[model samples]
Target: MRFTFTCHATDGHARTGVLSTPRGDIRTPAFMPVGTAATVKAMSIDQVKSTGADILLGNTYHLMLRPGGERLARLGGLHHFMGWDKPILTDSGGFQVWSLAGLRKMTEAGVEFRSHIDGSRHMLTPERSIELQADLIGSDIIMQLDECTTFGSSHEEALVSLELSARWGERSKVAFGGTRATQALFGIVQGSVFPDLRKRSADALKSIGFDGYAIGGLAVGEGHQLMCQTLDVTVPELPMDRPRYLMGVGKPIDLVEAVHRGVDMFDCVLPTRAGRHGQAWTWDGPINIRNARFAEDPDPIDPTSTCPASSRPSKAYLHHLFKAEEILGQTLLSWHNLGFYQDLMAAMRAAIAKGQFQDLRARLRQRWGFAPLD
Candidate 1:
């Protein structure tokens, strides 16, 4: 349960580091593809590993309601269950409950909600959330259960939510005691869009102490600029030596900007989700295979990509597969998208190590047709 972060270099605010865990060492400024139900949709675990992902994100809310946590423990943990020998990080089931909206009841104790799958009842407190993540799911990195506030909430509401989440963080830490040798518990910083409240949340989590820190409550609705602004204020308040994760974030540009603001880890479903809908992300930008122009185009999605989809398949063939509703199209596109994200992360890591992150960032902006926030 020993976790260590070794920072190798820093280019501006962006940093390159390695996170040492029991399963393996994860290169920081890393992207974790979401495997919400213990499986990354449309892709196999080996396929996911082939993309050079050092870690994967599992959803505590989904697994707990599906096969159940105790079932996963009996089956020898999530890693064995999913055939992913690499590290796994599981969210605390808070965000899912928050998203449940009218279906959930929130109080100082915890959240109670009906399962989205079966409409069954369940309660998720901080203690139970830690137990599910560490004891049952056997995740290497576990997150504290925190209330996820909405984007347009009032200042007072955000403050109250942040304080409650800090209290829950204390409970999660106490529950994670002694397991610190093999498991890491991270405290989540939640303050909506208020910078001062974000600072307060960071200070509270630091006093409570955690193996890592996560910037939550962003990317829900606040656009890229506001999200980065929140990170700008919150990141410096956290311990520089611990890994900083930006949860449920973002497109390719979002990853670059977050890293520029000192984020070390990220997980999102953008790549795979977009792939399922006949979309592809390239170094240049995103393209829709469903478009009529692709029906006659012979070029590959990304001529520079080494992935099979981007290297072997023609744009016309991919368009045909999607047009005919063939399953292989989505699978291949998912592979390519994941591969692209991994390559991007690797490039960023190298650029930061070589003190050329800003150069790389500018290059990517130019290629992707994006402009930096002014």
Candidate 2:
């Protein structure tokens, strides 16, 4: 597979670029809405496309266990299965394997765990993860296997996981082979919160080589400051010409901060999860529609926002829906939240290309009150 990253412009450490992949071209400073289990929960493919998302993420752990890769292949890959012609990126399921199952066994070969749903046994090695992702969806960007540990983990534990991920990254590359001509494999850099260990992980992955690099194992529990510190040391060591992804990252402020630290792409569940909880992300800050303050408020969530939820639904209506436990309310809110995130990413890319990212980030943080490290 051939992957090209072209840097369009730079503002401080932040830069805007376009990633040309066989599936499609993705504008840098991109936000991939999570479509775990091949669906962006509460929203349809057409609905998600309207949000201006260039790519969507699918979960390997979920799909492999449920409909299964073979079933997806028979169903004509994820694109046909989901009706999303745009690019699809799938996680290696390493993180899900670590987080989902009740018990898991890890070794140099791979991981063995019982399915969270029915306690069925399964093994997910680096080879199998790559095979499943490539042979099934043939995703545009594929993540390598990596151990995701919580923040404040011991340095030794983090280092071991980092080294193992590097090894798995190599295995994934070998398993990917040439048949994945349109697909690209990315390595995940995992080192918990230690800067030195992060560098070590970066160096190891670079030696192995990858289409892109992802800053994994972060945002689990480490606050924004520590995560940025890790990126501060980690990004400079990576090849600037390649895309850098910060996985499972969060709030608007977190996105801005990570961009400032040189992250090119991101994916998070905050927007959708928040929307399901009757919350909305706005220019001023995140506000819960269920809050009593919105009981009588007639204004839209954010009239200036592009997200349909932000302007289409009134605060009072949204509050009523959330209070009444209506599903449409959550669906609309999720759509709006996703739209807001895409809009934010577009704004960030534009601001960086125009050399105004610093000012933009500062203004956002000031207005958002430092983005509570959720």
Per-model TM-score versus the true fold: 0.98, 0.96
Candidate 1 C-alpha lDDT tens digits along 109-206:
99989988778889999999999999999999999999998999999999999999999999999999964687888999999999999999999999
In order, candidate lDDTs are 0.93, 0.88
Best by TM-score: 1
State the weakest 10-residue window (summed lDDT) of model 2: 365-374
Clashes of each: 4, 0
Off by over 4 Å in 1: 372-374
CA shift at 181, candidate 2, in angstroms? Answer: 2.6
Runs with alpha carbons beyond 4 Å of true place in candidate 2 = 371-374
TM-score of 1: 0.98
